[model samples]
Target: MRRLFPVTDQTSADRAATAPPSPGPDGDREWTFDELAEAYAYPPLAAGAVWLRGNMVATLDGAAQHGGRSQAISSAADMRIFGVLRALADVVVVGAETVRREGYRPARARAAFAQRRAAAGQAPAPAIAVLTASLDLDFSAPLFTSPLVPTLVLTGAAAPSERVRAASKAGAEVVIAGEGPGADPARAVSALAERGHRRLLTEGGPRLLGQFVAGGVLDELCLTVAPLLTAGHAQRIADGPELPVPARFEPVSLLTEGGFLFCRYARADAPWISRDQG
Candidate 1:
């Protein structure tokens, strides 16, 4: 189907010079999963007008890579939390590159994600979102082939004519959202927000994650730190002149499993920021 609001200059970064506020516990109350669940009662972070949640796995030594792939560092428990986080999200956003490497699906648990939404008077399934500078996508994959719900493909203005045609032919709903010299996550997230999707869960490939941070879109980060360290150098997360930003995260909570550490970070009330100042 044709996009209602076709974006012409999709690559232009929607960088609002001001940074989004960080989140944390209110008063003495700790921001627990249960509290967030209650607050985002509508399946994900809906109560908030705009909220961004990022999911990534890092190593104990603070390396995002271990072996060539993050799979080497992940354990069964880590995978489960990934699913749980997905289940709670209204829309799952990922980079096309991540889909090429890690592979992605709709991540809809009609029963689980549905149950939560149903209880909160929400829809049964959340849409799967893919960001790409090009409209290039394998429509044959389950992500696009599903006849019921159309996959939302976000692209930039510089997308080729043939690639756009191919995406439309493959039964995908393509929206030219952001453009950049590379990729503009700020525009992409704002485009989604305009579409009525408020609380978005971004499962990044690092480049997009960095773009969001630079663009000031991300509000919360759910990072799973595995106990094991991957010494391999085949990992890539962000691309920029100034890479590896020193971000201060206020730990909402921590969980340890199979020697892995699962930590949640909110931009609000991050004690680490103050510590870093010292």
Candidate 2:
């Protein structure tokens, strides 16, 4: 923690003591920094099993990215929200493709959250997860070398055991997300829930997010609508295949910051189509 940036409000012991358990919202929730944490443990106000919430910056025209990355849409306040969101996560799950494209590293600077976790008797680090259909990952990256917390690789049974072992050797936790040949998003959440991770924050690159919503596993959907407009080739988040699940879930809260629109949603019920679109 010596090389880390200190919290700005650390002078008062009382304030530091009550620094708030913030649930990751990327700064969209109406709750204060501390109120976000309350959202985490808050019992399901509805029917979704897991929160499949997403955080992203979209242009005014609804483009999720401008130049393959959504960086251009983020503002200073949104960045602060991003930090709080990361701190709220127990594990930050991402795809291998995203892991490589994002210059990814798992741990973030949230000394307050780390201290709170210590008080709760849990490790200060959130388990970084990489989801791969075939386990094609770069084992040489520092994301795998960080010993403070090991990355978890969630894969299917068909995922080669040899590759899983290699990932473990690279200092990652290779956990089979499901027992079958394919990855089941539902089973993956169940696996995490079994491990006591009742709250899951899933950051997306579009396809994965669509799958979560398509599979009926998303409990909450959090989106931070960026004010900028980048009418570019970058993927639009909701442009993927339509989800028959949860036809409609009402918004619990809405926030605006740095010209971005933050909307919170709760899943209503299972609304998957009666017939699979096979």
Candidate 3:
């Protein structure tokens, strides 16, 4: 793995304790799981709001997926970081479409993170929160029925009663955020915060990400740029209609391994303006 930049001299113990040695010039700068977890740790929290963060991966040409799923473009290192991020979050928010497409299962407790989670006062595993408007999800699926923490379905009051009933019966904790059929993303965040889930993480499927952006609730984005290019109709990272104005983000950090670039961008101080209000 090749890092874009050089690392400063560090203690022999700290350097050696990190992941395996890299074969490249940055041999002394190899990253271990412990080091990566520390680097990507969630920031200090605000008093009463959820710190929303999005994690995504894309190809060199900016294709978010190949053959209709993101797994084709993901690397082992990316997945390692993915697991660390999940272990750190209180809840993993996802869209219903992504859950279906990726065949997502309930997040289980990782032995590696078991101590850290317990020390942090977190549950054995992060709860999986599925965002849906119609509540058209499979209640029998492992995501709903077999999670360490009861799964949450963020929907609207206007969602189909039968579907809501089925989800509840299957051990899901359904949350109604808005009056309309579709949930208001801002309200969804608030609802999660009310339940004491302040460390929020969203693994999106584009459209749901767009809603977060539209709601001006997105605080940070962790994007992995894969070295390969898929020159097809593959979607971009965040897909939504044209915004009234552009949102700006500033780079926080850039790490690279095996030609893959891990980028973190934090939203600028620009005020968030929800589309519904605009």
Judged by TM-score, which candidate is best? 3
After superposition on all CA atoms, what RMSD does each candidate show versus the true structure? 12.1, 9.8, 6.6
- Please provide, for model 2 over 152-210, each residue's C-alpha lDDT reduced to its tens digit, 9 standing for 90 to 100: 78888888888888898898877787666446777777777666565577777777676
Scored by lDDT, model 2 comes in at 0.62
For all predicted structures, in order, the TM-scores are: 0.74, 0.76, 0.87
- Clashes counted in candidate 3 amount to 2
After the best TM-score superposition of candidate 3, give how far the Cα of residue 262 lies from its true spot, in angstroms. 0.5
Clashing pairs in 1: 10-178, 10-179, 11-178, 11-179, 11-180, 22-267, 22-268, 23-267, 23-268, 66-230
Worst 10 residues of 1 by lDDT: 1-10
Best by lDDT: 3
Worst window of 10 by summed lDDT in candidate 3? 269-278
Put down candidate 1 lDDT per residue, 58-156, tens digits, no spaces. Answer: 876656655445677788767766766666666788888778777677655545456566664434666778888765568788888873356778887
Put down candidate 3 lDDT per residue, 118-173, tens digits, no spaces: 88778999999999998878788999878889999999989899999999999999
Q: Residue 273 CA error for candidate 2 (Å)?
A: 28
lDDT of 2 at 245: 44
Candidate 3 — which residues are off by over 4 angstroms? Answer: 1-30, 270-278
Poorly placed runs, candidate 2 (over 4 Å): 1-32, 35-50, 119-121, 179-182, 238-240, 269-278
List per-prediction Cα lDDT, in the order shown. Answer: 0.62, 0.62, 0.81
Model 2 clash count equals 8
Clashes of each: 10, 8, 2
